[model samples]
Target: MSENRKSKVGSSAAVGNVGKKARNFKPTMKKLISYLSDYKLSLVIVLIFAVVSTIFSIVGPKILGHATTKLFKGVMAKISGTGNIDFNYIGKIILLLVVLYVISALFGYIQGWIMSGISMKVTYKFRKDISEKINRMPLGYFDRTNHGEVLSRVTNDVDTLSQTLNQSLGQIITSVTMVIGVLIMMISISWQMTLVALCVIPVSMGLITVIVKYSQKYFKQQQDYLGHLNGHVEEMYGGHIVMKAFNGEEKSVHKFNKMNGQLFGSAWKSQFLSGIMMPMINFVGNLGYVGICILGGWLAVKRTIEVGDIQAFIQYVRSFTQPISQIANISNILQQTAASAERIFEFLEEEEEIPEVSNPVKLQNVNGSVEFKNVHFGYNTDKIIINDFSASIKPGQRIAIVGPTGAGKTTIIKLLMRFYDINDGSILIDGHDIRDFTRGDLRSIFGMVLQDTWLYNGSIKENIRYGRLDATDEEVVQAAKAAHVDGFVRTLPAGYNMILNEEASNVSQGQKQLLTIARAILANPKILILDEATSSVDTRTELKIQKAMDNLMKDRTSFIIAHRLSTIRDADLILVMDHGDIVEQGNHEELLKKNGIYANLYNSQFEVA
Candidate 1:
């Protein structure tokens, strides 16, 4: 038990040490306010309701004080034998107080109803905007960012913003109004006592400000650790099977526990510091309450203040501290909201893909011809990958690209598909620059089967139909039969309707590859890109898939990237790539006689087997 306690204490200190001074937040806040500008009218209505409700509520204590004065005077008069009790006046005052309280509650409810809708609508629109922004972002952006970080921004940060708006937006306005109103009422009763009560404001604010100064860093650290923890967990879960197979469970868990501990420490400190605000504010309030009551009693005894006035003054003193405390709490919440808002804005402001042609040209009766004219390109211009690379292919050509790892094998396909634009030079399809076509139109002409198989949680048939949404059942089955996906799919418990599960773990990797092939075959694109498409399957399954691919490649431009030389032996033209440059280009028979890099690569593969 002692060790556990010590560990927790140490964990908190380590996490708390991540504190760094925050930079200027004015620009981020100004931009976020700009997003809220569209809801100006709705906010105006909310403001009106909040002000009216607060005004009505704040006026209540003063009117109730009138009833207290009336009751006190009546009792005193009866005891002094000066006059009779005026119960009628006292009853009227109490009735009006009840009516005022009810109206205040009604308006408060209406304000909350309207504000809830506005807050939710704003968050919904922000979420929608982020979703569209994600699509507009280049693939390179995703490559550089973690999937969980992006997801957390969408779910976590957006939720934090929404929650802050809902809980604190109205509190800020109402608390300010109540504080000003209470001060006025207190002065009207007894300015001397009001002066004493006013002392709580500065004391509470000072104490809270000092605590907040230290707490803000922890809050920011909490958010960062939360994001990192989420990303790490997502990665570990994604590769859980591989981790366990290699006996990496202990390492993964240790890393997770470390991150989780940091998150816990920061989260607790932020909460603990913020939580102290209420109790401390309440303590100072009680001190003021005691001081004011003592001063009011002496003033009443000296006949400088009436019994009713003293009662109203005491009520005013209590009400004053409540709003001050609420405002302090709201200030802390604003800091956290600002942190979440900054993260969200950063994602929304990321650079988008380059604009497409204003007046794009259409490919009419495309002959599947492609050409790379002195294309100079790189993921980053400082480090050029494909330099002065040039290639030309006729329609219906079976071109295989062979290269060692990191030789820009996949970069070539990405460029042709326009997933990433070339930095310099040009790529033309049928003599027309590829840039002259919309990305949607350019990508529409090609079918890609990558090494990774992506199947969402759905029925087997639904996954295939994703290729061509409008494809008929007959067409889906035909494509499946052609790719041999129907063979194993039919053996499942529910056959074509079998659920693939979320990770698509219900089927083997080889089967997943076959399903993707079926999807591509169903789409029947004008060009085909097979990137190690048969790497996951067995020799027998590879033969079946290869036969299907051969039939599908007829009369279509096909680019194959493979390390298996046997698979590409029949390729009409083989381009041997090393360090992003093609060193040799010829058919199997011709390259063999040359005994160049292509021959060496082919021989190495056979030797490995």
Candidate 2:
């Protein structure tokens, strides 16, 4: 598997899902054509070369027929003792045939080379477009949709598009040209024989039509099942440890087998239906060849056509049906390409995050005195998860949010950072509405260390440098020392230079959090958000990390969300939340005296002990 597929293990990028109901194909196809509008000149050149090449090939049979006729006439004259064999005529015909075939081959080569470049260039553009599109899309889109589905569009669907362009596009041009050019040559030699050869065309069309009608549904289903099966595999692999701990291995295996069976059924059915076309067309072609031979023989006996004309005409008829067969195959390829294309276009057209305001306010000395007034929001409008919430934090205050699992602790941090806009009212930072500032400007004022640690595959030093790109090596070490990450680095073989693997699994989870804390220290933001940042480590490690975070958050406004209530006893203000609303607010001693929800949650941790 590619790195992209590995990264998308739990997302739609491994699976395929087009947002909304599947659109009509014609409109999707029209949109795909619009992308090709940029390569019109290359397409025209490809067309000219294909036509020229086919025309050269089409004329070969007629010229070869002339040689056959000459040899025949000369032989009969020799039998009458009036003429000898004409080696000069035969030599000239052979030379002409060689020249035509060579030119045809050259044109075909140039056409393939040009189309290959065009296909690759178009695919590059599509990939770039998608990369840009995803960044601009709102975070809510990812929240609502499957990440695996998006991954499939980027890798699988785009791959199909590239193949079709490189192969089928050129084939369509050459096949059409060859069919037209061969038709003219056949009619010129003997229209009566041409008619007999053309007799099977309608039957061939009817067969193709019926097979295509039934086969397309299977092709579409095959794509869906492939994505579905991929989703199952991705999920199983991602959470295999959890499945095993719960003794659900048999269930997981059974689920995979079921999906695999569905995928196999759709996959082979589509292939078998499409595969049947080639042999059926070949059978029709053979019948046409037989009709031409029998008819041409009768014509020759009557002296209506020469034996050589019969041979050349037979060649032309054969060439004619070969392209028709190719076109049928290309037709099937085009249908699959169209399906992939529709999924690609659907993603490109998805609703994006509202564009940032032009000439937005830029913060100058952000002290991070944050306030939320009557803020209403939700991941979905039908169900509001944050309702009429309000809060005010003084500069340099540490606010600890304590609640049960679903009590909107992290939602407050997300809203403050403007990851999602409020449905009503405003979140103000430094006395200005957050929306007044650009997202980049707003986010730059704050640093975050979340429950899930994210560390890219890079040297430890480079990962720290991401926080402040121009920070000196000494500065990186200083930040590492402040976060206690320096202690761990000394034991590593490469020290700070040791490389992290793809998942950053080289370091322990507690160590990963320390590195992130070091990065946040390097950033030196005016505000900080720690969402269960120390929850993964042992008690000893948590104490060490908590000390480092305390130093890092000193004199900076910070919001800490921790499930362990004891960790936030020193917070200036403690907010007790239930559902989307805050139920109580005060210092720890004050909230404990109230004996309300906050006191109950705080005492429960000790009750278990």
Q: TM-score per candidate, in order?
A: 0.95, 0.94
TM-score winner among the candidates? 1
Q: Each prediction's Cα lDDT score?
A: 0.85, 0.85
Question: For model 2, how does the per-residue alpha-carbon lDDT over 1-609 read when each residue is reduced to its tens digit?
Answer: 110112333333433442222346789778888999999999999999988988888899999999999999899989999998798999999999999999999999999999999999999999999999998897777765556567778888899899999999988989999888888888888999999988978988888898877677666666666666666666676667688999999988887787677668867877898899989998998998888899999999999999899989989888988889889988777777777887798789999877888878887788879898998987667778777999999999999988877778887888888877878889999899989888988889998988888899999999998888899999999999988889889899999999998678889988898888888889998999988888778898788878988888889999999889889999999988888789999999999999999989888888954
Model 1: ten consecutive residues of lowest lDDT? 1-10
- Number of colliding residue pairs in each model: 0, 12
User: Candidate 2 regions off by >4 Å?
Assistant: 1-23
The runs of at least 3 residues in candidate 1 whose Cα sits more than 4 Å from the true structure, single-residue gaps closed, are 1-18
> What TM-score does structure 2 among the candidates reach?
0.94
| Candidate 1 residue-pair clash tally | 0
